[model samples]
Target: MPNNMTAVFLPGNKQVDVRAVLVPEPGPDEVLVEIKASCICRSDLSLYYGNAVISGGDSNQFVCGHEPAGTVVKVGEAVTEFAEGDNVAVYLAVGCGVCHHCRVGIHYLCAKWKCLGFTMDGGNAEFLRVPARNLLKTPKGMSHLAAAISTDAFGTLFSACRKVGVNGLSTIGIWGLGPMGAAGTLAAKAMGGRVVALDPIAERREFAESLGADLVLDPTAPNALDQVREFSGGEGLSGAIDCSGQTAAHNMALDAAAPMARIALVGENRETTIKTSDHMIRKQLTVFGSWYFSIDEYADILALIKSHKIDLERLATHTFDLKEAETAFRMFDNRETEKAVFVR
Candidate 1:
């Protein structure tokens, strides 16, 4: 392995450059991974566009791109589970395992939660160091590109569906038709739920239909809520998920949900707001803000993938070389690709 490597860094607004940096060494409980593939997530765009509040404040530039899959090159002294040459997928959310939340398997809610590529130096490079506890064993036959999406997109959807109690017969409504939304549709179908997807983009809606949505409705349509209600036999949806991160879409989700239904808010939106009383008490709705998945949940997701229950490969639309990182981010920013990846 080289002593140093080239990594993509985002210094500031619209400032992306490649530079040589020292390759990180593994700590006692961490492992150094030779990254094979990393996916471009919407959160990465937030850092590129200066929308996310990264660690070290807004002025301190950092490396980005978190969903990474690679081979373990070096293991820490205390790392007994993994060794060199082991193929793995890394969970981006890093937390101290001894913390209250971490002990209970709620790592995402850890007070010291620091996500890779967001609060720390991430996998937009040839190599990176990560906690051994966050590494997941990739399925034998899965490609690195597909495994990369499993870490974030598919994992997040799996967590959301669990939060909403999806059981094949539930009438579910999904707001947003992006990769996460589309993945949720598949998850709902896998659970035997009847899905109704809503999105303004014709292509995204069409994609949802292809994934087994009973109906696809335009969010901007005058009778969008009515359309969903009609599909649910006038009782409203059993549950809803707002993955678009739009305030309007959130309102629509609440409107479409049945009484006492649960709604998982998975996306990030700064300007979105909701009326607390009317949206909560009037409907007796349960709102859950899902971040990343728990370690136990992630393990279950991996097992499902290995069993051919989760089709993660369908979400990746494009793949690029690490040298073409700029092109990949550009395409992702413009919404030109469903999921873009950087293959090493």
Candidate 2:
């Protein structure tokens, strides 16, 4: 193993810094992974813009690339479940193991939650040290790029779709056609839901269509909701997901959903307003926010991936070497790519 490695850091003002840093050593309950693929996420943009959504630490000081997958190269003495040569992808949330949330494998909800790439040294580098419990075993033949994206982009949506009970009979509306929305489309379709996707951008709408969306519409159009109703045969959508994190999209999702339908808010919007009795009480709609998945749910997620033969690499519109961190971040920030990854 090399004594040093290259890692990327975002120091605000849309700046990216690639630096040579010492390779990290794993602690007693951790394993050191030789990173093969790391994906850039939309959430990382906040740190790039000099303001981070999650506070309590200097995000710039940590290596930044959370959605990562690779091979375990070294293990700490206390690490028993994983060893050298095992292929794995990391779950980003690190929490106090004894907490109620962590006990249930919903570590992100723990009071002492610390996230990879935000509060800790993450996988932007060639190597990353993470707790053994956070390591997800990758199935055979799963490409490194696919493994990386499956950890966050695909996995998050998978959990959300599961929560909303998407199935063969569902006609779901998805707002926003970014990687998250794309994942929602894939997950919804895999479970037999007819997806009606919406996006203002022509290319994103087209991308959603190419991903097997039953219908794609421009949300800004004069009668976008009308199109949704028409597509749903006047019954209205059975479920909806808003990945845009925009207030307008949230409102549209509620406005277009059928009575008794469920809505999962998977986006990272700071605030939004909704008509209480009109959108929820009257319609008897169920709405809830979903973040990452439980560790135990990975088995179901992997089974779905295998049975559906999901091609995660299709979402990766661009790939770059670690040295191209600047260009990669800039292009991703500018919305020029559908999905981008850093590969060894």
Candidate 3:
């Protein structure tokens, strides 16, 4: 094992750098992963711009890649379940083991929740030391890139759609055809839902179509909402997922939903206006703010991916070597790529 390794760091103000650092040693209940791939998420923008959405956005103190997958290279004495050389994807949210949320496997909701790349060092490096319990064993044939992305992109969308009761008979509207929106499109289609994907960008709309979205529309169009209504046969959407944090997209999703429809807001947004009566009360609609999935759900999620033959690897429009962190992040931030990943 190397005594030192190179890792990425964001010094705020859109600065990105790679630095030489010591390879982390596994602590009690921890395992050191030789990262094969780490994905750059849209949320990483907060860290890049110097105003992170997470409470403790200490850019200088932590490596900044949360969606990571790699092979285990070292394990602490207490880590018995996961042996060295096991391929695994990391679950970013760490919690106090005794908390009710952690007990229920929803680590992200724990009162003392601390996320990788936010509160702790993450996988934008050659190696990462994570708690063994956070390890999700990858299927035998899963690619490192797919495992990395599945950790959040596909996994979160799958959880969101499942929560909304998406099924073969459902017509689901997905707002914001970014990586998350594209992921929502894939998940909905795999689950047999008729998908209506909306985005202002022609490229994103086309990407969604390629992912099997039944309908793709420009949300900025004057008759977009009307189009959604008409597309759903004037019955309104059976379910809707807003993957864009934009207020307009949120409004469109709520307004286009049918009575008794289920809506899941998967996008991270600070604020958005809502028409309480007309969008919710009058329609008897159910709206949920869905975040990351419970740790236990990974099994079912992977199973669904296997059963549906989802090509998660195809979602990555670009992949960069670790040295190209700047270029990778720059292009991703500029919306030049659908999904981008860092490879060792």
lDDT of 1 by residue, 70-106 (tens): 9999999999999998889888878878988898777
Question: Tens-digit lDDT track for model 2 on 215-310?
Answer: 999999999999999999998889999999999999999999999999999889888999999999999999999887988788888899999999
How would you order the candidates by TM-score, starting with the best?
A: 2, 3, 1
Residues 203-272, model 3: lDDT tens digits? 8898889889999999999999999999999999999999998888888888899999999998889888
Residue 92's lDDT in candidate 2: 93
Write the number of the candidate with greater lDDT, choosing between 1 and 2: 2
RMSD of each: 1.7, 0.9, 1.0
Clashing pairs in 2: none
lDDT of each: 0.84, 0.92, 0.91
What TM-score would candidate 2 get against the native?
Answer: 0.98
